[model samples]
Target: MSKEKESVLEGFKAFLMRGNVIDLAVAVVIGAAFTNVVTSVVKGVINPVVGAFGTQDLNMYSSCLKAPCETNDAGEVVKGIPIMWGTVLSAVLTFLITAAVVYFLMVLPMAKYLARRARQQAAKEEVQEVMEVSELEVLKEIRDALVAQRGSGRNDPGRNGPGQSTP
Candidate 1:
């Protein structure tokens, strides 16, 4: 039982040490840190700009269905359903900011780089294809010249290839 437990622990340790597991852990940590940065930016920058249009604190925005939403005597809600629109709006703005930042800072540049690399590869292949076609054309011309020389009657002295003469 002790040996079995030891082996199990070692197996678990090995599993945790794998590259994928480590990479995933790093990604999760970085993602958390990035989230905090984005959240700070939203709170610091966007909230103020959006606040110009309305309340700076979106959490304060709400509507009560009943006229008497609260009772001052009890200091609590007496009768009414409060719709918290501010919370929803805050979440929507945060999402939009995150999406825009990721798209502009990461996705757009990566896409452009991949597109340019693909175009360069295609140009190289096109040039290689043209060179291959040119080589084939030259080969065909050489073959035609050889056939013409042979058919023109080898008895002629001038038509023989260099280093060869009609004997």
Candidate 2:
């Protein structure tokens, strides 16, 4: 029926609008932006520190061999290849800086936050379970009392026998 289809569509829409899904989307966007900031920090701040050691930028440090490798206008080497150690050094430095920043600033804090949140959620669930069990126990006690009262033998037409009807 069209009504059933409308209900199903409404339910799906509600599910998508839940807090968890929205929070996840926001986190993803923020995480991407954070990555760009970290990358730029590594390229700008960290690169300069490494460049202080008499290196014409990290990308130019290389061990050359037979010839001072000649490159065409398109930056392509025509004859011999230059052992580009500078590029490798720069990459290594960038990787190390990025790793350190991620570990200290993002990973550590996120881990601690998740651990704390999990502990709090577990405690809340345990309390809820205990309360539910207590409520069920009360209901069971009332049912048992009613059963016992009906089972007790009685001649009154309005009252049931112990655990039985008095019709």
Best by lDDT: 1
**What's the TM-score of each model vs. the native?**
0.70, 0.53
- In order, what lDDT does every prediction score? 0.84, 0.80
Model 2 agreement with the true structure over 1-167: per-residue lDDT tens digits: 69999999999999898998999999899868876876687667766777786653677677657587888999777777689887887677667766787789889999999999999999999999999999999999999998777565454567654576645
In the range 94-142, model 1's lDDT, one tens digit per residue, is: 8887789888988999999999999999999999999999999999999
Pairs of residues clashing in candidate 1: none
> In every candidate, how many clashes are there?
0, 7
Clash list (residue pairs), candidate 2: 61-86, 150-161, 150-162, 150-163, 151-162, 151-163, 152-162
- In TM-score terms, candidate 1 sits at 0.70
